[model samples]
Target: MRINVLQHTPNEGPGSIQRWSQEHGHEMYIYHPYQFGNLPTSDQTDMLVILGGPMSPNDDLDWIEQERVLIRQLLADHKPIFGACYGAQQIAKTLGYAIKKAPHKEVGWAPVYLKSDIIPGIPEKLTALHWHEEMFEVPDQADLLFSSDLVKNQGFIMNGNVIGLQFHFEPEADNVREIAINDNQYPLEHNDLHQTGKEIIDHGVPTENKQVMYQLLDFMVKNS
Candidate 1:
């Protein structure tokens, strides 16, 4: 299978997802518009994985809106999509949901409670990597999958083929360190909802979360 990833920045590239592709013997391609200077359509991509970025879907950027258009086209085609963080907000917006700044910044390791059983192997609570201050409401009729105390819509699935998560399900240790050093939102202030960079990195990133991520990705590939 051919999986294409839409990445917005250099540092926050697909981490374990890249490794998962290799292990599953699937070809993976990435689109970094700042580097490539062009976006790709979903004609050749069997599955689409949209990664998180610093940009909000409401930003005055062409690519942001273009990605949403691409998302709409993919939805019309009934293609499988996985949106994480900022990408998740985009998915919600495409379905006419409102995306707004979260009540507080969630910028470290935290727990997201699973609220639905549309997909198995996902736990009731998973510690995930988070780095965003924006959140989205659940789109109309979409299956709200996960939630946290800070937000009511942490994730949602539409048509069983498109999945969106407000947190990173597959967090690589190196990627965590890179974001901590570069994102400047890290070294979190004293708050119960946030964690320090060391606190997030010291545990070495839970292998179980990555396992759940792989299971969800495999399920999408099979069901798509």
Candidate 2:
């Protein structure tokens, strides 16, 4: 399988997802739109993985619009797409859903609750890294998959091929540290909602959440 990852920034790379791709002997390609100024042709991609970013989906950036077009094309072709955080927001916006500010920003490590056992190949609950000030509405055609206390719509799946997660399932220990130090711009008041740098590292890799990514990849590979 060839996995094409659309990276928005240097810090928010593929992280654990990269490891999963390599372990499965799948080719991993990264596109840094911020640095490269363009996206790959849809012909070159099989499964698309859109990573997180600090920017909001509403930002009137040229690359954002271009990526939106690419997302629409991927959906039209029935290509499997997995989007996280800002990428999820972009997916929501492109799918005709709305993205707006949440009541409170979700930062640090948080436990995401399973709304249903419909997650056939993954576990029920998992702790996922989160760093976002904006939230998105689930598309009418999609099913709500997971939710956290801070955010009701943590994830949604469309046509079982397109998955959007608001939390960071691909986060590494270093990624958590970087987000903790730099995400101070988004104020989070609830202490329980926050996690110390050491805490996030101590928790280590989210094995269950990582399995979800693997399951998603498996589904994509079989279906695609």
Candidate 3:
């Protein structure tokens, strides 16, 4: 499979997604719109994977608009398009859904409940990594797949073309370290919605989450 990845920041990369894509012999073409400028036409991309970023979808930027145009074009074509966090918000914004500041800033390892088991092998209770403060609503034609106490709309699926995840399922230890070090503003409060770097490292749920990420990616590749 030829996968086109939209990488907003150098740090917030594909993580486990890169390993999966390479291991499965899938060709990945990465577009660094933040560092460079523009993205290639969707006609050349068989599948699209938008990685997370630190910026909000509402941020008025030229690159943001360009990425959204690509996302909109991909979804309109009914092609497989997956998004994480900021990428998810881009999907929601492209689909005309609401994007706003979440009630709580969710950082580190947190438990979420699946509302719909659209993908196989996903547990009802999952501990995924969170690093964003913005939340998006489920699009009009999409199914709400997951939710948590802090964020109501965790993920959504529209047919097999569009998938949005508000949390990080692909972050490994090294990736988590990069994320923690890159964003000092990301809260580490010992509260209901946040956890420190040491706490997240001590919690060994990311290993499990990475496996679930693989399953979901496989399902999306085959079914989408």
Give the distance in Å from residue 72's predicted Cα in candidate 2 to where it truly belongs: 0.9
Candidate 1 lDDT by residue in tens digits, 137-187: 888878899988777778888788888999897668888878777765444
Task: Give the residue spans of candidate 3 off by over 4 A.
Answer: 189-192
lDDT of 2: 0.81
- TM-score per model over all chains: 0.93, 0.90, 0.93
Error of 1 at 199 (Å): 2.6
* Candidate 2 segments whose C-alpha is farther than 4 A from its true place: 181-192, 196-199
| Quality of model 1 by C-alpha lDDT | 0.82
lDDT order, best first, reads 3, 1, 2
Q: Name the candidate that leads on lDDT.
A: 3
Q: How many backbone clashes does candidate 3 have?
A: 0
Candidate 2 contains a number of clashing pairs equal to 0
Following a full C-alpha superposition, what root-mean-square deviation does model 1 have from the true structure? 1.7
Point out where model 1 deviates above 4 Å: 185-192
